[model samples]
Target: MGNALTTICATSDIHSPQYLELFKKALANSTCKPDLFILAGDIVEHNNIAEYRRVLELINSVHPGIPVAAVFGNEEYVGSEKEYVVRYPNVIFLHDNYRVIDTLTGRIVAVGSRGALDKPTQWQAKNMPGLIKYFRDLPDKISSLISQAASTNLPIILVTHYGVTYRNLTGENPAIHPYLASRRMENVIVNHRNVLKAVIHGHAHNGLVESIDIDSVKVYNVALPARGRIIKVEV
Candidate 1:
């Protein structure tokens, strides 16, 4: 990608108040000064929005002013997004949007979203029937965002909360693969491989393969419990 390397430290599924300490410990042990920090999704448990502040506090204590880019997860809930935006104005909350970050090394485009599942979970299907249409349309929306980012002529990083490809969900039950992530999203990344440098995601706590390559684009399942450490990426 860029001549000067850009370092990124990323993780997700903190499920705060439960795994908060685990995330703190992981951050404490990290030695890299990341140009960017990514919270793929599920940073807090349920809709406990207050815990997000604590998570940001921990990150700031170590690397003050480090830009954080994030997407929503199932735990973030639907109605609570505004609370996070109002509470953390400095944070880049990408809900089916893109942000171009200019680091000391080079500029890169980060496209973020809650992502889509091939098949909605039973709970989702039952409670949020409207989501079926949203899920159906998400892949195309994400692709459009990537296409927009490509106009910048910068490498793009796709960050989402759900698994993008089945290859990374190896340990999870095959029957539930459709519920974990969508192959349609994977198709979007493969189609935009020219500028898509990597993909980072969470929500697969049981995923066995932490990282994989799809059409040469690196994909990471950065669930805190799955890897038990922060994932560092250089591009």
Candidate 2:
């Protein structure tokens, strides 16, 4: 109804030199210049802080002063290099956190978390008991952040390393769907659909690149495996 905010979302297991190059090209020549850049998650190959730095530098080169909001994926351990990533000028790490960006158009409230599963899978078993419990209980934690962002009365954009809706994971191996994302998280989005403009996530490499509606809110899979493309959403 008014001038829209353009957001470019890119995600999935980028850590290789080649993938990073592709990512840089995508952002530099985006279909539309982004007002806000959203890095959905799993950005590094193996907790390589240098790779994260490259991604940050590339993003800044593409869109100088634009704010970049990010979340972590299963591959990235929060404390491993999170402190370094946050040190970047305009990068905001939103793993289990929230940030509000005041754009020229209007206020943008972004909430993000690494998110977790509704049940334990093979991957969960590999982690220690404490971590397993933490991942399993992610739905409740992220839901609280959603509620907090909702109270801001600004357009809300959600970023996560895990897919919130099952439909968005289409084409991924069904046998490992439980390990990939959570359905409980989708319920949180459904409940707060009124103010939510878009939900972006990655992690299901085999997932479909689609835009589906949860009420009026759009949930999209921006994983790079299927296509090295950034999704553009107007808020």
Candidate 3:
């Protein structure tokens, strides 16, 4: 019933300290194979497709053919011009999309939804319509999972680049808190909470390291814990 991870690494805002070497060390140094490797968000400081490509190559080198799922933080949004990072294989980028990883232990459903705000200054209340429509549209990234989940007995992991609940926005901007988190997203989560095992989010760097309650399901703020730490979600 808890988000218990036996072996895995989670980090966000990893643009600094150049984590490529450190990530390799963690994978090599560990005795057990990692169940997952997650980059919460802010993987890159600015939108640099070249850097994204390099990061992808470096990660593949460390854990070649390993499945690594990631969500883009606000910093990663670069209009429609950025393509290399979003299109890379091996790296599953969640943009309102979901993926199911059928592991020996259990099945995992990973869905990611993150994009620009119609008007960042307007805040949450005003963005409900657009947000809901976006939700209804889903994304190519997650289309397959919508159907796959019907036939499989897998635990669902809702992954996203934004913080959908206010529970995690503890240290975030008070005036902008409404804008930082998603109200429309909250509605979607609560509706599907029963089937979801947990949710992983990025965006709120200053958010609390706590679990959010989405009806019966527990959502987690998996942003980088300072650095070199991973939160395990064991079902």
Clashing pairs in 1: none
Q: Tell me, by lDDT, which candidate is best.
A: 1
| Per-residue alpha-carbon lDDT of candidate 2 for residues 1-235, written as tens digits (9 for 90 to 100) | 2456555555556654548877876766677577777877778776665677788788777678877778877667656645646565467778687888765456688888877765556555665456677866777787788788888777788888877877777788777787777888888888878777888888777776567898888888887765577677778
Task: Note the residue pairs that clash in candidate 2.
Answer: none
Please provide, for model 3 over 1-235, each residue's C-alpha lDDT reduced to its tens digit, 9 standing for 90 to 100: 1244434445555553455455445445644455666666667666654556656675566656657777777667535334744466557676655667644344577766663322354433364445545544443324345445635556666676666767667777666665556655665666665566666666665776567677877767765533234456654
Candidate maximizing TM-score: 1
lDDT of each: 0.91, 0.74, 0.58
The ten-residue window of minimal lDDT in model 3 covers 115-124
TM values, all candidates: 0.96, 0.89, 0.70
Model 3 score (lDDT): 0.58
TM-score winner between 1 and 2, please give it: 1
Better of 1 and 3 by TM-score: 1
Residues 1-235, candidate 1: write the lDDT tens digits.
Answer: 4577788899999999889999989999887789999999999998899999999999999989888889999999988888899999988899989999866567888999999999997889999999999989999999999999989988789999998989889889999999999999889988998888889999999998989999989999999998888999877
lDDT of 1 at 134: 94
Least accurate 10 contiguous residues by lDDT in model 2? 1-10
With candidate 1 superimposed using the best TM-score fit, by how many Å does residue 166's alpha carbon deviate from the native?
A: 0.6
